[model samples]
Target: MGCIASKPPIDFSADVNFEHFKLLRSVGRGAFGKVCIVLKRDTKKLYAMKYMNKEKCLQKRAIRNVFNERKILESLQHQFIVNLWFAFQDEEDLFFVVDLMLGGDLRYHAQRSGAFSEDRIRLYTAELMMALVYIHDRNIIHRDIKPDNILMDENGHVHLADFNVAASIRKGSLLYARAGTKPYMAPEILNKSGYNQSADWWSLGVCMYELLRGKHPFRGGTTEEMLEMIQSAPIKYPTTWSEPCISFLSGLLERDVTKRMTITSENVQEVLKHPFLASLDYDKLINKELVPSFVPDKDKVNCDAMYELEEMMLEDNPLHKKKQRLQKTTMSKQEQAKRETIGAELQRIAEKFTVYDRSKVKSTPDVALDTNIDDDEITSASPRPQRASGLAVFSNEHDSSHMSEDENALRGDSDSRRVRSQSTDPDPLELPTRLVTPVVDDGSSTSSPIQA
Candidate 1:
C-alpha cells in the first residue's frame, strides 16, 4: 500500500471587512476601540477582533502607530508572541484578528491567584525571557512589558501581546522616546536617558518580583514618590526567597544600564545561565516543552471582573451615538501620495493570507434581533454561547467613558495598575492617544513613556 499524507489544516481568509464575521459580546475595550469575540461565518473559527474606528484614530493622530503595529506584527512569528492572523481595513475601522487567548492576561490571573510560588514564577519568567530574547535578536524593543500585556493560553503558556508601542531599532542604536507602563519601566527610561533592549529586562524583573511578592518592589503613594523610590530605594527581597533568586533579580534590576544583566549581546546568555533559571532548558523552554505549574480553568475563559463587566455592558442599550464617517481633509499632494503608498502596502499584506469563499456566507438580515436582556429579569448565568450561525449585531461606537471605567476597575492598586498623565508633546500625530496618559502612580507628576 502507498503511504498516505495527512492533510494540512485549512487557513481561511476573508475580505478586509467586518461583514464576514459575526461579532459577539465585547471582551475588552481600550481608549480608541473595543475588542470583541468574533466568529468567522464560513469556518466557524473564533478570534478576538480588535476594531478601531478610523475617525477616532485619525482624530487622535494615531494612524501612524496603527500602521507601524501592523507592520511589526506581520513580520513576527514566534510561539511566545501573540500571532496576528489577519490585518484588514474598511472605510470605518481597522481590524486585527488575533489568536483568542482564553486564559486571560497575567494581571487577571495574578490578582485572582495571589502570590505565586517560586517554582511557578520561575516558569513564567523563563518563558518571558525566551520571548524577550526572540524580539531583542531582531533589534525590536517591546517598550511595553507588563502583566496585562502577557496573555495566558489554555495550556498555561503565556505569549507577549500589545505591540502598539514596539519599535524596530538598528544595530547599536538607542531609542530616546520614553514609552512603557510606569511601574515596570527601568530607571534609564524614567530618567529619559537613551535606553535599549536592557529596559525590557528590567520590566521582566519587575514582573517576577510582583508575581512572587504580590506587590511592586518600589512602592509609594504618589507617582513622584514611586519614581524617587525606583531611583533610590534598594530592591528588597522577601525573606522567603532563596539567595539564588535574589541574585537573579538583582542582576536584572541593576540601576546602571552598563551593569544590567542581558544588557549586552554576551551578557544575555550569562543572565540565562544564572542559578534562578537553572531548571529551565533554554532549547526546551523556547520549544515550549516545559509544562507550566498553573493552568487556568478552561471553562472560565473570562475572569470574574471581565465577565461581570461584559454582562453589565450587554444589558445596557448599545450607545446611540451616530457613526462618524471619515473624510480626507487638508492633505498636501505629497501627503496624499504617502497615504496611498501605505494603503497599498497594507492591502498587499492582507492579500497574502488565505482567501475565504464568501459565497458560503449567509446574508445579513434587514432587522437583526436585539439580544440585550433586562437586568432585573436575569437568572442563571450561562456560558458565553458559541453561535452556530447568525450574526450578533451590536453598535460599533467607541465608548471612551465606559472603557476608562472598566480599565480603572479591572486594575486595582496593585503593581498592575496603569495610571495616566497628560502628554508632554502637543502634537497628537507624533504619538498615539493612549501614550498621552503616562503610566504612573497616584497623583504624582512622574509619568512613564506613553505607548506610541
Candidate 2:
C-alpha cells in the first residue's frame, strides 16, 4: 500500500490531511476524479479540492501531465491566473487544493446573456492577453484557452485556470496532442506535430469572436465537420461588432501561425494600440482602474446598504402606485411555470441548431449522472445555490465591507448607505470611472536605461 503522507500547514499549523478536510459537496466530477468543496477544519478556510485517483490517472498515462500541472502551478503567480495553494498525495488520490472561483466559468455567463458586449469582451481579452504574456514568457504553453477554462472572481476579473494539458518547453521538446477546444484551436494545434505559444493567441481570438458575436467563428456538427470548417473558416467581420473590435480580432485570428498577435509580440502591441482599447492603460488596468467592463448583476453582489437605499428611493417615487399595479398584474404561478417550461423547450431546440466543433476539449470529466452529485457539483459545498441578487461581485465598494461575499455576491454588515440616485441604471454603467494609472506625458523626457 502507498502510505498517505500529510505535510504541516503553510500558515495555520493544524495537522490536516485528505480525510481531515471537511467534504461539503461535489462541485464537479470527471473521468479521473471529482472536485468537491472542502473545509480546512482548523483554519475554517474553504477550497475546491480536486481529487484524482492515481491508479486511474496512471492507467491513462496522464500522471505526467498532472505532475507538469503541479509544477507549473507552483512556479507562477499572477493576477489573471488561478492560484494553486498546494498539492499532496494520499494512498489512492492526488489532491490539489485550489482557490475557489465562486463566479463560475465564462461559458455559464455567455450562455445566460446570449452574447457579451464588445466592451465586456475587450476587458476579458485584455486580461487573457496579460496572462498569456506571463505564461509564454516562462516557456509554458497553456495549450488550452477557452470560455470554459476562464474562471471569474467576485470582481468579474478573469483568471486562466485548468493547466491539465499545459507543457513546459525546451529547445527540442515535441508538443503533441490534437487537444484543446475544437472551435478555439489554432489550425497548427489540430495538426499536432507541435505548436508554440501562438496557439493560445489564436484561441483567444476565437474566444473574442464568440464573446462579441455569441457564436464561434468556425463551427459544425461533428468533430470532422468542425475541423474542415476551421480549415476554411473566413475572417468575416460581423456587421454588429464595433469597428475597433473587428479590426483587433481580425489580426489575432490570422491563419498564419507565425503572424498571430501575441501579447508581447509587436503585432499584439499594434492591436492594443488600436482605438478600441485606446483608453486602456496597462499599469492602471492591473491596479484596478479601467476595470472590467462587465460587472455581475448588482443583485448578485452584496451592497447591503446601497440596495436598501435603492429600495427606499423606489418607495418614495411618485410611480410607486403604478409599480405596485405592475407587480400585481405580473404572471401568476401557473402562467409563470408554463412560460418557463415553454422557454426551456425552445432553448433546448435552439441548442440543436447551434453546433460547434467538438475536438473533445476537456471538462472536469464525465460525471456520474446519478448518485448524490448535482450537475453543478462545484457548488455542493454551498449552503444553497446563491441566486444572483446583489451588486456586481467585481464592482468597487462605496461602503466598507469587511469580507467579500461568494462568487456572485459579497456580504457585509454596515449601517451607512451611499446615494444610489446619481448612478446609471444598469450596474455595468455605474462603475467608478477613475483611471488607475497616470497618463504618460509625451513632452517629458526620461533617461533610457543603459545596457551594461
Candidate 3:
C-alpha cells in the first residue's frame, strides 16, 4: 500500500481580507449563518466560506461556542476532518475559509442510495472512528456526530465537519453541556448526567444503525417522547445481520458509560479489535491506503437542497442593506456612550505617537529641529526614529515589553499600534449585555442537527 502524503501546513499567520474572495454562489445555510462557494482572486483557489452575522450570534448567546469552534479547528490537522485555512472577522460578520467538499455530506448520499451495504458501512465507520480517536486523544469531544456532519470529499473519503458544539475537557472531567441532536445523543446526555468523550461512540452507533437500517433504531415524534424512547427502547437488529455486526453495535450502543467500548483513550484499541472490523488493517486505513468501497460522483453536485436554500437566503440577506440603513439604524444610548469612550481614548493615544512606514522612507538630508517653527509642518526625518527593538512604535506612552517575540512577529506594527492605542479603554468588541438568559440546561432547545 502506498503511503498518502500529508497536506502542506497552512500559514496560520496569513491575514486574509474578505475583499480578496468573491462569492461564486451560495452552498449551504445554518442557524446563524450561510456558507458560499468563494473563489480567491489572487490564488484562484476554491474554498467554502462560512459567514455568520455577528448580531445574530450575539442574540443567540453563541459567541463563546463560535470562539471555541475556531480555536479547535485551527489546532486540528487530520485527513478525515475539514481543514480551516483562514479565519477573520469584520464589524458585521465572522468568516471561516475551509476546504470545499463538493461530494456533500453523508446524509445526502445515504438518501440517494437508500440503505448502504454492511461493507460500505464498515469502511465509513472505521474512517470516522479514526477521526474520533485523533480528536479524543487531544481531550476534544465532537458532541454532534450525525450523518449530516459527516462530509465526503471528491474521492469518497469521509471527513467529519462542524465543530460548533464540540467541547474540550480536562482529563477525567465530565461536561454537562446539553447540546447535540436528540436522536444521536447518548443516554447519559439525554438524562442530563455529565458525559465525557464516550458519548461520541453512542452517536457513531446511531449513525451506523441508520446507515444499515435506513432509519434510527429509536424513533419518536416529540423531543420528550424521543428522550423516553432512547432510555427505554431496545435496539432491534435485523435477523439477517451477522453475529459480529450485532456484537459491534451492542458494544457501542451500550447505555452504561462504564460498560461501553472506547470510553477513554486507553480503551480505543478494544474498539479496533471488534470482530466486525477484522478485515480492516488499522494502519493502512489510517494512512489512507485502503480503497473506499464507494466513491461519490464527482461530476454531479451531491446536494441540490443546500444550493436551493442558499439561493433563497442570498436574495433577502440583511447584510446587503447594512450600508444603506447605517444612519437610520443607530446604536442604543449605552452602546453609543461606550463607543465614544473608546474613540476618545484612541484619539488621545494617536496624538502622542507617530508610526513611520519603513518602505516609504526616502534618502534625504536630516533637517535640524527649529523650536520656533510649527512641529506639524516639518516632518522631522530624525534617523528613521530607530524602530523599537521589539516592534513597539509608541514612545514612552505604552509598554509592550511583556509581549512575547512570537506575538510581536504575528501582529503587523500598524495593527499592533492601533490595538495599543485603545489599550486603556475597555474592549470595544465586547458583546453587549443581553436580557435573554444563557442556555445552561436542556430547556433551551436548539435546531435539529439534521442538515437541510
Candidate 4:
C-alpha cells in the first residue's frame, strides 16, 4: 500500500550545541568573541550568540576566561539581568546563547533621553538594587557596572549585562583583583586594597550621577589623571539635584569603603531604609509587575550597526564563506599537521566545557520572560535603526594580579580599541566622574567608553 510518508519524530534529547543556532547577523563584538543575532533552528527562538574563535582565544590566552564566563553565567539566573541560556563549543568557536536585548543599552538611551527624570532614575536604581541583592547574596561581584552594561528591554526596564569581569569572593576573604572599567571602578579596587560587594554600589553611584545629571562626576585627560582624580578628588554634586539624590550619591560614591561597607552590604535600601524606595514594592519589582515609564520603540534596533558591518562587510570569517573556504581549500601536509595540532588542543579544551540546555530544568519558571516578538517578526535580519549610537569599547584592563588569573584575566576584551575623547560637554556616558550635567544631548556629540 502506498501510504503517505510521515516525518521523523523530533529528537529533543540531543545536546544543544553550536549547530542548533542559525546566525542572523552580527550585533556586537567583545575582546575575544563576536555577538551575533541568531535563531534556534528547532524552536526558532531568537538570541544573541557570543562566539569566540578557538584559535584566537588560545593565541590571546583568553580561552580560560571565555570558559569562566560560561561557567559563571550558567550558575546564575535572575531577573533584571541578562541571563545565559545555552553554552556549547565547536572546533572553531565556543558559543554562548543569551537573552537578546533589543531595546539597546542605557548609554544609547542616555544619548537620546539625556538625564532620566528623578522618578525614572529612582525606579532604575531600585530595580538594579534588587538585582544586586540577588547577586551579592550568591557571593558574586559584578565589577563592571557602567552604562554599557546596563541594557534595556523593549519595555525599557534596565537589566544588568556583561559578566566577563565578574569575580566570586569567598565568604570572608575580600576580592583583591584590579578589575572593572576605570571610569566606574570603586576606589578600593583602584588602590589595590581588598574590596567586597561595596565596590559594586560605588559603580552604581557613578551610574546614578550620570543618569541624574548628563555628565560624570569625575573627569580627566588621561588614565593616570583619571585614576588620581577618582582616588583623591571629592565628588561634587550640582545644586539642581534633590537633597535625597545628593544623599544617595554621597553614600554610593563614598571613597572610604568603611562608610558604604555595611549599608550597601546586601542591598541599597538599608541606608535609605524606605526613604529612596519608600513607595516601591520589592516583590513587584522582582516579578517585573511594575512597568517602566519609558518604553523603547520596538520598530528600531537600538545599537550602532558597526558589528553587522564588521561581520558582513569586513569579511570577518565564520559565515557561509567559512564553509565555502574550507570546502574549496586543498591543504598542504604542513598546514594539515598544524590544523591537526589545533584540533587536538581544542578537543582537550572541549572535554572540560560543559553543555547546558535551559529547557531541561522545568522546576524553575521564567525569571525574566522572553520577548513577545514572534518568529516571523524577526525577519531575515534584525535591522538596526539609524542614529542608534552607543558605540564605545574599552582599551585595556588594569591587571593587578593580586588574585588568581582566572578571577582578573577576563576583564580585557581586545576586539578593537577606538577612543573618542570629547571636550567635556554632553551625555556623560564613559566620562570623568566630576559632577556631570544630566545625561542629555546638548547639541554636541556624546562621549565614548573610557580606555584606561
Candidate 5:
C-alpha cells in the first residue's frame, strides 16, 4: 500500500471559475484540498467552498467517494448535520459549496479551553445522537463523527459536517472495509470484521468520552494495541464520573455491536432515560430547538496559531507531517512512519492529560476579568464578546508567552481550540439563547456496569 501524503502541496494556481462567489480566506486545508470562505455575488450569502483536485482525486480513486458523498448529502435534510448547498466540478477540481459554520468545530474549542462543562457536552452529545438516528434511518452511516466534522452555525445549532467517509446501508447487509479515526473506531471495525450503523454508536461513545475527559478512552503504541484495548473491557470512567453517565457510556461502548445503542433498539431508550441526558428535551432537540453552546463573531479559525503549531511540529518532531492520515491522497512509506511516530507521542500526551476529573471542575471558567455568569450579559470587549458556556483560554492576555513553542506544535490541541470557541462567543446573527429541555427520566432503568 502506498503512503498517502497527509499534507497537500501549498502552492496551487487559483484560476478556476468561481462564477459569482468572491473568495475571502482559507478556512481549512487537508490532504484532499482546501475550503475557502466565499460570498455569493447575488444572494450575498457566505459559504465554505471545498476544492478537490480532479487529477489527485483520480489517482486516489476517490471520484466515486466524492460523488457518493454529494449524492447522499443532497438527498437528506437534517438540522444537526451540516448543509451541503451544491457541488460542481471543473476539469481539474471538484467544488463543494456548503453552509459556512462560523463556530468552526468542537475539537478546536476543546483544545483551547482544555474541557467543556457536563451541560455543554450533554447538549452537543444529544444533538449528535439525534443526528445519528436520523442518518441511520435514511440508511446512511457517518463513519466519521469526531469533533472536527461536527460544526456549529450562527444560530448555535449543531451540524454534523464532512461526509467523505459516509456510506449507504443495504437492508440486512453489513459493511466490509473499516475507516474512521483509529481512536474513535469501534472494536468490530478495528478487527477487520463487518459492521453497520452500530459502528457509529461506538464512535459516539468515544466522542462523549472525549467531550468530558478531553481525551480518548483508549491510547496505544501500534494500531494493533489500540484495537486490543477496544476489544477488551478496559474502558475506565473517571472517579468523579456520575453513575448514570457511566451507565450510558458503558452501553454504547459495548464490544458486542448487537448490544450497543441503536435508534430503534432498547439501548436508545435506555440512554434517553439516563441521568446524563436527563436535561435534554428530546422533542426540542429533534425539532432543532436546542442552541449551540458557542458561536464566533467572525468566521475564522486561529490559522496563525495553527500554522505556527504545524511549522513547530515539523521542525521539532521531523515526523509531524505524517501524524495524521490524509483522507485526500494515498499514504507513502515515509509518511506512514511519521504517522506512527506522532500517533505514539500523542497517545502519551492523552494519557498524561486524562487525569482531570470533569465532575470536580466548574462548568464555566473563573476568569480574573469581570464577566457576567448570566447567558445574556455581553461585556464591552473590543472584538465583542458572547456568553461563555464552556471553558476557553482565549483571553485578551493570551500572548506568545502563554504557549510554548513545543506545546503549540501539537495537532490535537489545535483541533480542540475549534470546539472551545463554539461556546465562548456571541453569534454573529444575534440569535437568542434557545434553552435545552432536560430529559424526563421515567424512572425505568437497566442494569449497571462493573465499577472501574
Candidate 6:
C-alpha cells in the first residue's frame, strides 16, 4: 500500500505580528506613543493600533504603567470603554489593537462643535454612569476621566479610553498615586487624602459641568491656583442651568465621601434613578437604541489631520519603513550585551509578556490585578533616574524600603504623606508643577527616500 500523505502544520505565526495589518492612517498620540488605524489583512477588520517603543518606555520609566495597563485591559470588556482585541510585541515595540472610535475624542468635538445641549449631556451622563457601575464592581478605578480621554464613535456614542494611569483598588483600600490631570482631579486626590472610588464620581461631575459650561469648574492661571480652587472653591452653577442639573452636580461633587453619589453594583438602580437621568431608559441605553443628538459626519476622518502630516514629515522611523524590514533588528555587540543584562532584570521583576488573543481563551485571562510596582507618590517623589546618554535603565537594585522624604514638601514625597498627618484640609498652597509615521518627500527634506 502507498504511504499516506499528510499536510504540514499551517503557519499561524503571521496572524499575530506586525505583518498582519496594513497601516491606514495616523490618528492620535499620547505621551507614550501614537495610534494608527489599521486593517487586518486576513479578517479585513479595522482596529486602532497603539504602538509604544520599548526604548522610549524604559527611558520614560513607563514600562510599569504599560504593563499594568495591558493586564487591566485584558480582563475588561465593556460597552462604554475601549475594548482590547489583541496584544503582542515586536522586537522594537509593544502593540495593542483596540476598538476604533472614528468620531474622535470629546476634546476635539468640544472645540470645533458649539456648546453641547443639556439634554445631550444628560444622555452622556447616563451612559458613563453605567460604565462606572461596571468597572467599580470589578474593583477598578479610571483615574483619568477628562474630555480628552473620552472618545466618540461614528454614531456619537462615547467610550472611555487611555488606561496607562488607571489603578486597581482592592476592596476597602484607597488609591494614593498622584495620577490624574489638572482640573479634572477630585478634591481628595488634590488634598492627598487616600481616595476611594468616589474620586471617579468627582471627575464625572466635573465633566458634566464642563460639557454644558464649556469650561472646567475649577480654573486658575496655573495648576497651583487651580488646585486651590478644587480644594475649597464652591461649585457655582449658572442661574441659567436647571435646578435638577445643579442638584445632580452637587450630589456628585459633594466634598463628603458619604454624601457623594457613587455608582456600584448595589446602587445601580439608585444611580439610574437620579433626577438628572430620571427618564433615561436603562435597557435602551445599554442596547444603544436611544438615538444620540450629535452624530459625527461619517464622511470625515474625525481625528486631527496634523497627526498624519507629522507621521509623514517628522517620524524617525515610519510605519512603512518598519514594514519593509520584517527581520529582527540586528543589534550591535555592545547593544546586545546591554540587552542581555536588561533581559535578566526584566525577568526577575515581571514575567514575559505574551501575545494575547481573545478567541483562544475560554475564560477571562489569569492576569493579576496587582501592578506590583510601587505607585505611592512618596516612593516615586524622586523622579526615575535619568542618564545623559538617553538610555536610562531602571536599576536592578531598586529598594522600596530605603526612600527618604525630601525636605521640600511641595514637590517631594511630603505631598504623599499629608493624608496621614491628621490634617482634614488639603494644603492650600500646594501645587506640583510638572511615535510616528508618514511622509511626503519634499525636495527640501533630508529624510531617507520613501519607497513605494
Best model number under lDDT: 6
Deviation from native of the Cα of residue 191 in model 3, angstroms: 1.0
TM-score of every prediction relative to native: 0.67, 0.60, 0.67, 0.76, 0.63, 0.77
RMSD, each candidate, Å? Answer: 17.8, 20.4, 19.5, 12.9, 20.1, 14.0
Lowest summed lDDT across 10 adjacent residues in model 5 is found at 417-426
User: lDDT per model, in order?
Assistant: 0.60, 0.54, 0.61, 0.63, 0.56, 0.67
Q: Estimate the TM-score for candidate 2.
A: 0.60
TM-score of 3: 0.67
Quote the positional error of residue 431 for candidate 2 in Å.
27
* Clash count of each predicted structure: 4, 17, 0, 22, 36, 4
Model 2 CA lDDT for position 399:
8
The reply for model 4, stretches above 4 Å from the true place, is 1-12, 261-274, 306-308, 320-329, 332-344, 361-452
Please give the RMSD of candidate 5 to the true structure: 20.1
lDDT of 5 by residue, 283-391 (tens): 7777877665655434334222233233223322111122232233776798667556544433332232121212233442321111112212211112221112221
User: Can you list the residue pairs that collide in candidate 1?
Assistant: 13-356, 178-449, 179-449, 421-438
Best by TM-score: 6
lDDT of 1 by residue, 1-452 (tens): 99999745334452545555654445555544556556665566777777676545544534444555666666666798886776666644677888877677877666656677898888888778777887787667887787778888879899998876677766676656555566677888778676888899998888888878877787776666776788889888888899999998888899998888784445555666778888788778878888998887654443323232333345322211112223444767985775675554334333432232224435322221223222232211222212211311111121122112223322322222212122221221332222222221122324231110
Return whichever of 4 and 6 wins on lDDT. 6
Alpha-carbon runs more than 4 Å astray in model 5: 1-17, 265-271, 291-305, 308-452
Please state the error at residue 113 of candidate 4 in Å.
Answer: 3.2
CA shift of 443, model 6, Å: 28
lDDT of 2 at 358: 18
lDDT of 4 by residue, 46-115 (tens): 7877878877765564554565466567667878889888887765677788998877777766765677
lDDT of 4 at 326: 52
